[model samples]
Target: MSERQKPVLRVAIVGAGPAGIYAADLLLKAERPFQVSIDLFEQLPAPYGLVRYGVAPDHPRIKGIVNALRDVLDGGNIRFFGNVRFGTDITLDDLKRHYNAVIFTTGAIRDAELDIPGIELLGSFGASQFVSWYDGHPDVPRDWPLDHTSAAVIGNGNVALDVARMLAKHAEDLLPTEVPANVYDRLVASPITDVHIFGRRGPIQVRFTPLELRELGELRDVDIILDDADFGVDESDERSIATSKQLLVINRILTEWRSRETGRASRRIHLHFYSRPAEILGSDRVTGLRVERTAPDGEGGAHGTGEFREFPVDAVYRAVGYFGSPLDGVPFDDRRGVIPNRAGRAIDDEDERVHGVYASGWIKRGPVGLIGATKSDAMETVQALLGDQSEWWSPSEPDTDAIPRMLEARGIRYTTVQGWHRLDAHERALGEAQQRERVKVVPREEMVEISDPPATAQPT
Candidate 1:
C-alpha cells in the first residue's frame, strides 16, 4: 500500500493529565511514517487531572496550565475518553487488542509515608488527603474534620506550603476562587488558628518554589512567624544560596519576614527550618510534635543536632512527598512507588523491556517536578516510544472502536470530549450565576451526570 494509504498507528494513553496530554500532543505532531490516532483515557470525568483537582483553588497562576492542556485536547487530533478507568472499565489486554501501543501516565495520587512514632494518631493526617478535600477532588469526602486550633505540617515543598496556606487563610479570602460550596463550608468552620510548617533541612535547602514561599506571607489575617535562631546559616548554606536563585530568593524572603514585627492576625503560620520531626506526641490524638534540631553537615545535607523540642499542636499533616499507586497489570516497584521503566519503556521483573507498554511522568520517575518538568518528561517518553515503532505490538486488524464498544457492553457511563465541553460550560454558567470564576462540582455522580452527553448522542 502507498504511504498515504497505510493504516493509521493507533495509540492509547491512560490518564489525561498534563503528562498524558503532552505525550499525545507530541505523538500527534511527530513526523512519522504513518498517520497516528491518539486516544486519552481519564478516570475522572474532567481533564487536566492535577491542575483541576490538586492545585490550590486560590492559585490561579498555577491553574493557568489548564489552558495549554485544553488547546491540545481541543485540537480534535485526539479523542478524550473521560470517566473511563483502566483496571475496571478496561484492561491491558483490551488496550493491546485495540491499539499499537499503550502509555500509562497516571500520576502519583497517594502521599509518601513518613516513618515516625504516633503517626497513626487520631489527629495525624496526610497532606495529600487534606489537599484533595480542599481542592474538591470528587473521590474524597466532602466533610474534613477541622476541630483543631493548631496544626503542624511537616515538609518544605510547595505542597506543604499549600496545605499550610489553606489551613491559615481566612475562608472569605478563598471566595473568589473556584472552591466548591462543600469545601468552603467546612473550611469556614475550621477552628484552626495556628499552622506550623517544619522542615528537616536548613532554609537554603527548602524545596518550595519562590512564589509559593512569598504567597505564605500574602495570606490575609495571617502572621508569618520565623524564629531568629532558625535563621542561622552556615558557610555551606550561604554557598548554596549564592548558587541557586530559588534558594537565594526563598532565603531572602524568610530573612525579611524574620525582621518584620508580628501583627495581631487572627491566624498565624510558623515556618521552622532545621527542625526534623522525631515523633508525633499524644496518646489519643495529635497534641504536640517532637522535633529534633539539625545543622548543616557541610556536604549539602543536614545532621541531627540531638537537641529535641516539642511544639504543642492539635493536628499533624505529613507532606513529605507523593507516591504512585500501582496499576492493575503494570510492573511497579513497591520500594520506589514507581513503575519500573528505562527511558519510559516498561520493564519486567527481569529488567527486560515489556514491549508495547510504557510509562511517563511521576509514575515513570518518582513523584517530583512541576507541570513544566512533566512536559519535558513526556517528551523523553514519547521519543522513546516513537523510536521503538519498528518493534511495537501490532494487533491483527486493530480497531480503535473496539474499546468503546467494550465499555458500552459493560454498561459503563463514560464521558466524552464533547461531554467535557458541556461540563466546562455548565461550570462556567454556574460561576456566572454566582459572579465568580467557576464553581466546581464536587460529587463524582454530579460531575458524571453533568458531563454525560445526551442519551440520543452516541459515544464518540
Candidate 2:
C-alpha cells in the first residue's frame, strides 16, 4: 500500500524529557514502512525534564542541553502538549484511544532513600529536592531553608558535589545564570561555612566524574579539604587507577585538592572518603552526622573498620540517587523503581510482553548514566515500538482534533508549542531587564498564565 493510503502510525510519548524527545526524534528519522504521527505530552508547562529542573543552575554547560531539546521540539514534525499529565490528566486508556502505541519516558526525579538512624531529622534533606528548588522547578516550594552554618552532604556523585557547591558558593556568583529570584535570595541569606561530602569508598572508587571533581576546586573562595589517609591505596587500587582514565583524573583532582592549603577561604567543602554514614545525629533536628570509618579490602573495595565518629553540621543532604514513582496504570517494579520492561517493551509478572506499551530512560531502567546515555536507551525503545507494529492499538477516535476538543470540553487548560515559545520569551525578557541570561518562572499558576493566558484562546 502507498504510505498515504496506509493508516498513519500514531504514537503518543509520555514525558517530553530527553528520553521521550529523543525517542520521538528517532522515530521521525527512522526508515519506517508507514507514515508516522507523534505527540509529546509533558507534565510541566516547560519540557526538557531534568535538564531544566534537575540540574544545577550554575552549571550552564550542562544546562546547554536544553538547546538541543529545543531544536527537536521546534522541528514542527512532532506535536508538543505541555501541562498535560500522564496518569490523571490523561490515562493509558486515553492514550490507547488516540494512538497506535504509547511510550513512557517519565524519568525518575525523586531522591532514593538513605535508610539510617535519625535520617528523618527536620534539618535533613534529599539532594534531588534541593536540586529541584535551585533549578526553579515549579512543583517544589520557592523558598529553601539555608539558616545553618555547617551542612553535610551524603554521597560522592556529581549531584552531591553540585549540592555542596551551590551551598558553598557565594550568591553573587550565581547572578549570571538562570537561577530564580527566590532561590537567589535564599542563597544570599545563607550562613553556611563548612559543607562536608561523605563517600563510602576510597578516593579512587568515588562515583564522581573528572569534570565534577575538578569543579569543586574552581570555587572562588571556598576551600577544598581532603584527608591524606583516604588516599592510602594499595597495588590493586593503583593498578585500577592507572588503567581507567576516569579513575586517573578523579584521583588527580583529589590529590591536587589534598595538597592545597586551607583555612584562608570563607567557606570550605571537605571531601571525606572511606566514611559510611551510620546515623544523622540530632534530638529534634540535624545537629551532626555520625559515620563509620572504612578500610580498604584487599581486592579493591572498602569495609567498615568498626570505628565511628561524628562531624558537627547543622543540616544534612542525601544525594545517593533518584527513584522512579509508580504511574497510575503502568506496571512498576517497586524494588527497582522502574517499569518491568524487556528491551523497552513493558512486561507483566509472568514475563509476557505488554503489547503496544513501552518504557524508556530512568523509568525503564533505574536512574543511572548521564543525559547523553538516554539517546541509545531511547533508540532501543523506539525500535521495540516500531517492530511491534502488528499489535498496535485500534483507536476509536484517531482524528487529531478529538483530544483537543475533549480536553477543552473538560477544561483541562493544556498548553501547546506556541505556549512554550511564549513562556520562553517571557522568561528571557524577565532576564533581559536584569542583564542576565534568563530568569526562571517558579509558580505553576503564574507559569501557566504566562504561557497559556486565560484571556487568549486556548492553545491547541
RMSD of each: 1.8, 1.7
Q: What digit string (tens of lDDT, one per residue) describes model 2 on residues 1-460? A: 9866976999999999999999999999999778889999999988889888888888889878888999999999988888888777889999889899999999998999999999999999999999999998988887888999999999989899999999999999999999999999999999999999999888887788898778879999999988787776555777888899999887777777778888999999998988999999999999999999998888767899999999999999999999999988788899999999999999987888888899999999889988778999999989888899788889988999877877777677777888889999999999999999889999988888888834346556
List candidate 1 segments past 4 Å from native: 1-4, 454-460
**Alpha-carbon runs more than 4 Å astray in model 2:** 1-3, 453-460
TM-score attained by model 1 = 0.97
Q: What's the lDDT for candidate 2?
A: 0.89
TM-score of each: 0.97, 0.97
Indicate the worst ten consecutive residues by lDDT in candidate 2: 451-460
**How do the residues 253-368 of candidate 1 rate in per-residue lDDT, one tens digit apiece?**
98788888787888999989899999999998889999999988888788998999999999999999999999998899999999999999999999999999999999999988
Candidate 2 clash pair list: none
User: In order, what lDDT does every prediction score?
Assistant: 0.89, 0.89
